[model samples]
Target: MFALLPLRRLLICCLSLLALAGCDRPSAIALDQQVYIWQRQWRAAHAQALVASHADFSTLRVLVAQAHPNEGWIQARIDNDLLRQDGRPLIAVIRLDGQLPRLDSSAIDQHIQTTVRNWQASGLNLRGVEIDHDCANNRLSAYAQLLHTVRAELPAGLTLSITALPAWLSSKALPTVLQEVDSSVLQVHAVSRPEAGLFDAQLALRWANAYGAVSSKPFHLALPAYGVALTENGDVESEAPLPQGGSRRELHAKPEDVAKLLRDMQAAPVPHLTGLIWFRLPLAGDRRAWPLVTLQAVLHQQPLRSNLQVTVQQQGELFELRLVNSGNLSAALPTLIRNDAAHCESGDGVQGYRLQRAANTLEFVRQSPGQLAAGQSRALGWLRCSQLDHGGFRVSP
Candidate 1:
């Protein structure tokens, strides 16, 4: 018994040390949330979109300029009045064409300096400038030198940042490149080939861990809030149509997947991870982007639920069918909508559905998959029936 006393004391001391270490582990902190408004053209709807997202996002990263090899520099026609009215910290983003064999460093520096001066002169609250150039990993050293020059050219009070790619993880010059900027944004979405799809949560998590391991400065993760269409000709389209004739596959970033990623990051908390910057603020009637309601819910970590209801509005012998989503999440359009009616003169499906007529029944079959955003309604079809049973409508999702 006397001999076992020292061993028991040693075991207790080790356990106590382990418990203290566990307790000392850092708790996850609330990260700052920002958004990107990448629209090249300023429209009336952009004002409303900015207002809708103003409460959730603390900073706005706006695409102010783009440099192309052939087209040279094109400045975005932003609505300065609307941006002034919105009253949020703005980060002007300058995108350089990645295909350029070499950069015009002096021209880039001049553009940056001029844009900052012009934006500030317009009474816009410009806080930072971000350079978005997806240069190859091997070109990182040259990219770093460009960043260093740009950083020096920026106004004294403004911060400088860069949009980084996961491919740079293998480059030894990554540290040197990072050293030139005040911050970096790791864009994990849409980095892979279109065949691999838009996003992979597990792979993104691994990249985040690896980034955190290497980056000494705070970095933000640029997540996708929208999607794109991949054409058979190996072309990706967003907000435009390709002239090529072929079938296209639409890929979307699921809100649930992003929410789960946020939760996972919060639980584990990557070192030097500062915040999340969602790509492209959603505007009303923007088909490719997630609805503002759904995006807001995901940002706040709210539970997602979508309730789609098929309702009928009648006027004498004419009946109109509509689908409404009352829940907070976006719902998929129903594959089938069945209704029973007797002696129907004419019936037609209006939107993305096809009308099928059978004895004593009218069926509206979806022609293609679509989403009905939360709090939105769409007209399915109309029917002119002598005797229409309003209660005989069935919806299959």
Candidate 2:
């Protein structure tokens, strides 16, 4: 008994160290980054945008079909040539109307099959299909059946995924629904009503952990990279011009908030959390989406900053004032701009700024709130001053 005491103590110590090692083990899953190109129409700019963003995103999830409330089914006109040239792994997404009375499983399956065949015929590197449906919790079981049937209909090489909602976390059928699909994407952004705003980082983190607990298979979190304008009549406009009628409120997800969330998630990763999928890739002229540089910086865990400068160009007596954002982050337009110029003949502001000229100072007052995307320039106004000091311009936020 005396000889066994030291051995037992050594055994206990080894067990304690093993338990600590188990507790400190890193997650086995590596995060795969992806982006969604949700544009309905593909243009030259879209092609260029895809080329620019091809390296950052591992997979491209393109919108293939959308079910409208009254227009029935609308198919997206994808740029096959561009997609083939890019040669990235593709996952076609089909959005279903949540308010639909019933599911047309057969028709949907046929559509999915036809789409896959056509894309493959076009030489696209198609790898999978993702169904984006935000149905009620009670309907999850039915949704699961639909997914199961769809999975059976897809080709052997193709995988199946679904866009999940946080609301379904409470449902007992969530596990069953998750089991039907090969993987899932938990959309935490814009899941609430319009009044609730676009994104809540804390709430999103909580939802993600909860979803990780429920989903057995690997899953991704769909985060926002764009803003939406909500109209007084309850109309939401994303990547489109708001109709000229009622008042509108713009809701945007701050980059800093999202970066903080990403850091926290990296520090303590949720279970089975595979990666993040940014919603809607940013195009050159996309006013609502974050600039590509800003998005890239956030994804790469770089610092975020915006350097706004007022530059004046002179062609003889005519001077053009412009606002230039040279930093990696988008910046809010300055509320005021003052320039010291004497003998100003005439000056007028353009693009929502009003010019006020005093004895020796030119003041440009902001008429509305706006954002200046990174690496972009906007013409504030032009000035015609005989003795203008271009170096004496000041910008006030």
How well does each candidate superpose onto the true structure, as a TM-score?
0.88, 0.89
The model with the greatest TM-score is 2
Q: What's the CA error at residue 386 for candidate 2, in Å? A: 4.6
Q: Cα lDDT for residue 297, model 2?
A: 89
Write candidate 2's Cα lDDT for 104-205 as tens digits.
999899889999999999999999999999889999999999998999989999999999999999999999999999999999999999889899999999
User: What is the model-wide C-alpha lDDT for candidate 2?
Assistant: 0.90
| TM match of model 1 to true structure | 0.88
lDDT of 1 at 80: 93
RMSD of each: 4.3, 4.7
Give each model's clash number. Answer: 0, 0
Extract clashing residue pairs from model 1.
none
Instruction: List the pairs of residues colliding in candidate 2.
Output: none
